[model samples]
Target: MLVQNSLSEVLRAREELFTRTIWTDPTSQLQNRVKGSELSRYFLLTESERIGIEQTIRLLVSTTPYYLSLSDPTDPNCPIRRMIVPTAEEAVFSLEESSDPLDEERLSPVRGLTHMYPNRVLLFSNHSCSVYCRHCMRGRKVSSSGERMEKADLETAFDYIRNHHEVEDVVVSGGDPLNLADARLEWILHELNQIPHVRICRLGTRNPVTLPFRITDELCKIIERYNDDNLSIFCHTQFNHPKECTKEAKDAILRLLKVGVSVGNQAVLLKGINDDEEIMLTLHKKLLEMRVRAYYLYDPELIPGSRGFRTPLARGIEIVEYMRGKIGGMGIPHFVNDLPGGGGKITIGANWYLGYYPKTRQHAFRSAVTKKIHFSFEPVGSDKESYYPVLSEADWEKFQAE
Candidate 1:
């Protein structure tokens, strides 16, 4: 368990490790974030690469100095740089890609509240982030114009949740909920606590990865206040690469854990970023060490300008299969794809269950350890019965008797 004293020690050492001026202040960190084209000041880019990034600025390009400090300025192929810096490939779009790939807007009954799942709803609290990820599925809204949820908007969303008694889960997301002021975030949590039906409130933010300074003691206190038996609060963050699991990021996660707020990572499988098996294994292992559970390894969504970052669906399965026995079960995340057109998330994995053969009265499975096919016969006198395979007359008679 992380104590306050240890966290203070980490914060004090930040200056030694990172020369950034705003390592302790969240507001200063945001104010100093490098915006589009400004990224070249921190990272070295060729003339063509610079032009390509400028062209894709329509999607918004922003990164905190702390995050930028992690990149290799000389290496354009650096995984950390590839995530925040846009490329010419983003300009090339397929007909299958969409601005609202998840169909979030179509499912949204209110201005910012999307009620896609029966018992859950996603609330867009604001339109700002510490860093604008190039592969964001919500590229249409996030970091577009610095719009935020006003009091009226919050009330409307709150009213919607109140009316719908079936809504047990409310996901407070936006550009990133942590970007919201502490008072506002507390108000949002308080409102949800009032709703008898609402039992779970999830704050979806990438601040922990991009801007760990945002997870202050004050913020954790607000989270601890409302997080109780009645309303459980969980922070769902995205950490795509192993480099993101820095000491600061781990300390941020520890702060949340110290407050009884569970932290989980939902990493997207990017083509050149974290598609490798070893990279993912190391990331999950680090997350477990920080007491953050590995939640979902998402297959990249079919969002506009994101084809450059997306990997084949099969690639995600292969990574999951490779990591199964290598890591603890808790460290392994569910590999899932959030279907386009808001069809919702569905878990996908390697076909370990080959098939069931009635002819042999057995089930076939591919062994994870041996990487070979194996079979197990159906138990006799099971409550559920299937057509048994043909056998010798004596054997058939014995089977029937059993």
Candidate 2:
């Protein structure tokens, strides 16, 4: 486990690195690096090659000084670079792509909310991030160029939650929740906490990785203030590669953990990034070291202009099966496919059949509605019959005679 110590020195280091970040422009990012103008020194890209990438993709670069410092400018295939840096390959568009592959726009009841599951609502509070990842599922819609939730919109969202008492959980997401000011974030959380039925609130962000300073002392206090006995607040972030587990990132996560807030990870299974099993195992193990649960290994969605990041489904199954029995299940995340056409996320695993038996209807824990893992929902609950075909004595005798 990563124990928190006197971080005065660590904080200073992170702060120094934080100051070196380049945002808004790719050209600025290149200039801030050791050798930015001389692109041929690092990447073998022509002037036109660079222009093509910038023109085709709605490029929004927000790479932090801390994250950029951990790169090898020599190796073109560096996983870290593959994540944030856009390339000419992005221009190679695919006909099978879409503006919203998961069809989130269709299910959205309000402007900022996507109500997919019955009891949970995904609330997009902001439309910006610390770094603009190249493989973002909502790259087209949330390009950071769009406006955030207005005051009236926030009130409307609260009203939506108040009216729908069924929404027990709300996931605050967008570009990243941390991108919003502390006051704005607090307002959102405070409103959600007021609802009697809202049990869990999760914020999906990438701030801690790209911008560690976002999880400040004040933010931690805000998280603590709202986390009461009735309502729980958790922060879920993404870490695709092990290189992202920097000292600064760990410190940021530790701050959240020390507070009443729980932290979890949602790693994207991207090609040329964390596609290998061992590479993933290390990344997840390191997450547990920082006290973050490895929650979901998501199958890259069929989004427009993201064909380059797609990996085979069979590889995902292979990794799951490899980890199921061989390794301890401490930090193993569920491999899931965010089913096309707004089907929602479905957990994928190795074939669960034992030659004669059919595919499992239950999850690893034997819940009939495996999707609702924690909830004691229907058929699988104790209210249901323990054993079916409870034959009477007469019926048993008649069957034997027959």
Candidate 3:
């Protein structure tokens, strides 16, 4: 287990890695908020990567909604409290946990591109970020898959995109496309720009958060080379803890922004990590300041050994409620979960009753009209059962029985 010493130790550690000037007014206020440790300055993603951002700091927060249960705030037994601060048990649970939880190979078409969705395609390559995450959903493919996306695969994917006129958008992602050499990435971008039907090109990478150095001046220039009215880059950067956002990471993010890339962050709402309301609020605030739009704040999946990382729906809802009116609408991210059985990603957002409010239904019945209510509303709750709709329960049961 990692020891929790006084905030002084954290500050001292920060002083060692980063110069004192980095810890200016705004940073010092944040540091004072999380009194125990100087988490942001010290927790580097991987040894080779630059030290993390010096501004992020974790705090004692909760996931319980203000409308729901807020009592007994300190125990992990509570759904909202389970992962506020991860224990050593949670971090090093076991190695048997499969890394590639999605098993995306089942959805691959020809090469590199995965035509999982009808209108969209995923370009999977061997590029990776600065560090390998222990709880990475694609853990299975990163190190051992030995599957480098060859030129043939890129051509096949591009060909598929061209043939399928319905495919109006393409998301270029891999372990981390930024990890690919600048020349190779430029080649891919150049090819995609030629496809007239392809209206948008989105690049999914985490270099801005993991290995900020990858976003060099040359890389920025290549990305800018393809940036026009139609082509825009989509970054799926993850930041589980506030401390992970370092000055170097910030610099990397600015480079992409300078080049006109549409930057967005996709953070997984881990149990003991940044599951607290204060921590989440601060992180979101920082993202907006840095010009990064906060995307999905996901609930960790129950992949083989990922139980320790999973948080209940209520915990996630609690955090949302806390930040709803408190912060700007743009700062809030929709909570989501990628369901099992290769179902597409779905957002778990605050409940907006599409059919009818209970009172509305009751009043309608009183008026003597028995009519079917047909309304489609998006859900933002904790129920896993409703996460996916690709197959109905009956259909799944039928398939299983067969």
Candidate 4:
């Protein structure tokens, strides 16, 4: 709820930023995206770099003008460029990598709908993105075709959700859910809002980072409309590094928060992008400043052609361990690994619990922040009250007066 000003101010400022650039048309940014070999025209790529990119281009290669402007054309190792541009390393596949590492297709109850958990389901709203990330886990599905969910497909998914009362959460994701037309997106929200049993609807998108212009007043109005006492709406976006926390990105996040939409970030721990503890900490801290919660810091999935981005499991643990007390708890995201082969997600972090002694009824723990050992004695059976402090009559009387 940071920027509670009028929507016109936000739009005017956004337009001013792009007034002299080719990205003046906010709505057409997606359609005007640069792709594949066309990248050479925008960035000053050397001959070797151009060939390397062309050779390693397997997944769809595209980036919005807004995102492309964030990169340093001369630096090949620029984090922004590394995310959207392919390198020769992408062609080198590892034995453990799989296109569908999570086995989402096998676990799908209906086409485009993956009912992985009992209470929640993932709905693929579209198969397009303004910027096709090089380390995308769903590289096989996303950006393969510029397809949106048809009415029939949506009805089938809706029917499944309606039939299963146990499902209270629905995650509308895709290459990017915001990529869909405003009317189309509104329709999906409307249908989901009609579901009486559904309590939470989360829109998974990276627009705030990749295409801030997409978060228009009209889109926010649609989001605000569906949000009510019956159902709550939340937006989960990706922002891997502090550089991505631009003024435009902050405005977009504030716009969502200004409405009733709860905004959160799910940063991926990429090798060359945000593997460093300092970088990750800065990214999360910036997100907190924008009124966005740091939700998850994901360990990169074993997606094909993503070996260059993946870091050793120990690296993620080390980064999270380093961030323990540097910032507030709200800025620290849960380090998690979405297990491959449909095993599901599990939290991965430094272990705090040391051991427990039966005879002494004591539990030992190591502080992640202070790096000190502490012990706590459990109360005897049916005597939990003994563990709490007892106030004297005089102390109780003084507390009441206060």
Best by lDDT: 1
Model 4: residue 250 alpha-carbon error in angstroms: 0.7
Better of 1 and 4 by lDDT: 1
lDDT by residue (tens digit), candidate 1, 1-402: 111223344344333335655577878788777776555555556554576576773368888878877887667789998888888777777788888888898998888899999999999999998988888878888876645678898899899999999999999999899998999999999999889899999999999999999999999999999998889999999998889989999999999999998999999899888999999999999889888899999998888777788888899999999998898989999999999888999999887875555555666667777776666877776644344333455644444454
TM-score for candidate 2, residues paired by index: 0.78
Off by over 4 Å in 2: 1-52, 357-402
Candidate 1 TM-score over all chains jointly: 0.89
- Please give the range of 10 consecutive residues that has the lowest summed lDDT in model 3: 359-368
lDDT (Cα, 0-100) at 227 in candidate 2: 92
Candidate 4 segments whose C-alpha is farther than 4 A from its true place: 1-24, 46-52, 146-148, 382-402
Q: Over the stretch 1-402, how does candidate 3's per-residue lDDT look in tens digits?
A: 124444465446545533432332222222232221222232222211111111111111111111012112223343322222223333333445444445467777775667778888888766443344445566545544466778887887888888998887788777777777788899988877777777778887765664565677888999898887656655667765566566766888898889888788888887666779998999888888778888888877654445556678888877876787667888888888776656878877553322223211211111112222233333444254333334345533443354
- Model 2: per-residue Cα lDDT over 190-240, one tens digit each: 999999999999989987776776677888899899998768999989988
TM-score of every model versus the real structure: 0.89, 0.78, 0.66, 0.87
Residue 164 miss distance in model 2 (angstroms): 0.7
User: Which ranges in model 3 have alpha carbons more than 4 Å from their true place?
Assistant: 1-103, 352-402
Minimum summed lDDT over a 10-residue window in model 4 is located at: 1-10
**True-vs-predicted CA distance for residue 5, candidate 4, Å:** 44
**Best of the two (1, 3) by lDDT:** 1
Q: Pairs clashing in candidate 2?
A: none
- Using lDDT as the yardstick, the better of models 1 and 2 is 1
In order, what is each prediction's RMSD in angstroms? 7.8, 10.2, 12.5, 10.0
